[model samples]
Target: LAIAHQYVTQGGLDYAREILESALGPRKAKEILEKVQQTIRTTGFNLLENVDPKQIVNFIQKEHPQTIALLLAHMEPKNAAPIVSALPQELQVDVATRIATMESISPETLDQVEEVLVSQIKSLFGGDVSEIGGVKAVAEMLNSVDRGAEKNILGNLERENPELATEIKNLMFVFEDVLLLDDRSMQRVLKEIDTKDLSMALKGASEELQEKFFRNMSSRAAEMIREDMEFMGPIRLKDVEEVQQRIVDVIRRLEEDGEIIISGRGGDEDIVV
Candidate 1:
């Protein structure tokens, strides 16, 4: 009650948890947490290898059996669904089928394990959410009611980066773009976007996003963009916008199934295909 009151008064859960971790759980939770911390300290950075796997394994063995089983089954899935979620449809099908076959678990047990796992996941995710910047930050951009549903997990990490926010605004292509061309025509158009345009685009993109674009583009086209960027003279945004649009249109036509992002001269220069 006092901790809850303090949290209400202070407007945060951190303080409350800190007080409790320090004040309560001396025999069980506190001792366990302290021992874990001490182990990590003794092991230093290389401690991952030295750390006993049974700490986790034992936790499962000694805890309520139902909670133990659920924790084992889900593990990282409790928070990293976005990264694992996009496994090829075949893999998704297989995993989903296997997971579905497990005996049903009690809701109360599931909830108990979930509360702790969710907290751990938030801490794990929060580190990523805090360190990433530029285009690499797309995880947080997605909306998820819970950690498991977050589609843009990468964007959450991006919340700290102004540059990443801009890159995300740049890569917003859609899947319905296949209607843009037949396969043969798409190949031809893909060849037309020179390295110059890509390099220009890269100037505004995150390294990961830039690599995705380059991988999708033809080698010749990528090289051409490079040449263009090299030979291209510095010019006004008006000229750049015109060229950028043409390049993006070509990329869109080539991809056939996705949008090509083109950076325009206007303040809203980021165009999504």
Candidate 2:
């Protein structure tokens, strides 16, 4: 029963229940299954979620945009984001547009896509498909991707589908978008950031962004940050990006907690008060 319950939580509910029914009578298995269902929230079963994003990217890169969109739409945004980022810039925009504008995919279509995915990744097991994709999903996926890819995709998307692009852009908040915060919100965000991370993150920041943070800090503290960055010398772009992402995550968390407000851009209406 414990093992079966574990399987249920790990996205093998049907297989778990089937084995339980064989080991125990239908009545016993049914009772156990019912209890597990009531106690645990399943994210539905998706073997694709466990596969490495790089492997998925290699297999799907040559596929049609719509086919790639269908697979990514079914995946968790975190997993899907990297795969999208890894694609060629042109394909990235094509797939993102498909995901944003995508509607419900018929089960027949899903089955066909699923077969292709499973056959390519052979180790992937069958699992249930739930509804996914649209502007919100695209936004979430874009939010996880690197700034360069995000900008490139959105730029192309803006030309291809202006309305849809605006909707997606409205939902996203990139690392550089921290500049959208007011002085009060920026200070609040700064208080939560580590000095080391701030220095590293600012290494790759634009002059305008550096000034935004500097203006919020005491003159002495801002000078110290500049000294640290100057002494650090050449740093890997990947390391800089990682630290910037962490700082952006802090900003998003503070915003979610209502401790800060990110002002609107991309023609969003300004706050009245």
Question: Best by lDDT, which number?
Answer: 2
Against the reference, the lDDT scores of all candidates come to 0.39, 0.79
Residue-level lDDT of model 1, residues 63-173, one tens digit each, is 443343233233333232332243333332233223323354443543455466555333211110111122212222221112232223333424544454344334433
Model 2: per-residue lDDT, tens digit, 1-273? 567779786767788788888999899998888667533422222567787878878888988999888778877888888898899999999999989988765545655665666665654322233455899999988877766687799889888889998788666777789788999998898899999999999999999999999999999999999999999999999999889878877886786565777664221233456
Which pairs in model 2 have colliding backbones? none
User: Model 2 off-target regions past 4 Å?
Assistant: 1-45, 123-130, 174-273
**In candidate 1, how many Å is residue 222 off?**
12
